[model samples]
Target: MRLLQVVLAAVFIIFQVLPAATRAFNFERPCYLRGGICLKQGTPDCEPFRGPCRAFTVCCKVKGLWGRAAAEKP
Candidate 1:
């Protein structure tokens, strides 16, 4: 019984607690729509801009949808 408890506790710490502690949290900034562009609905498009969405700025689309855009290199 004691061995089982130790094994379970070790597994929990190694698989759960350790990963959580060492994981890096990515707080992505919300994308912003550029002005002067009309937004549509249905189907997500992140064209004209490509790749992962930029920090704090959203990908622009004719339709308002979630899509990835290019992240500027530092």
Candidate 2:
């Protein structure tokens, strides 16, 4: 009765408010390095190998810094 009503109200409010409050985030992964240089983008040389990963993922190599690809698009 009253409990059911409250639960329904809560669920309704969550459904209405949750999407507006949520935000998109980028995921980061570890990049592999070779001979003082980080591998180029789209290189399948990630150590502890993660295979056939998501399309948004890339091997980031900047100068001598190496890191996993970050979310570039939603």
Winning model by lDDT: 2
Minimum summed lDDT over a 10-residue window in model 1 is located at 34-43
Number of the top TM-score candidate: 2
**Tens digit of lDDT per residue, candidate 1, span 1-74?**
99999999999878886666544332222345433122221224433332234343343423344444332222
What is candidate 2's lDDT per residue for 8-71, written digit by digit as tens? 9999999998776553222233445332222234445432223333444444433335644332
In model 2, what is the error at residue 52, expressed in angstroms?
A: 23
Clashes of each: 7, 0
Q: Where is model 2 poorest over a 10-residue stretch in terms of lDDT?
A: 33-42
> Which residue pairs overlap in candidate 2's backbone?
none
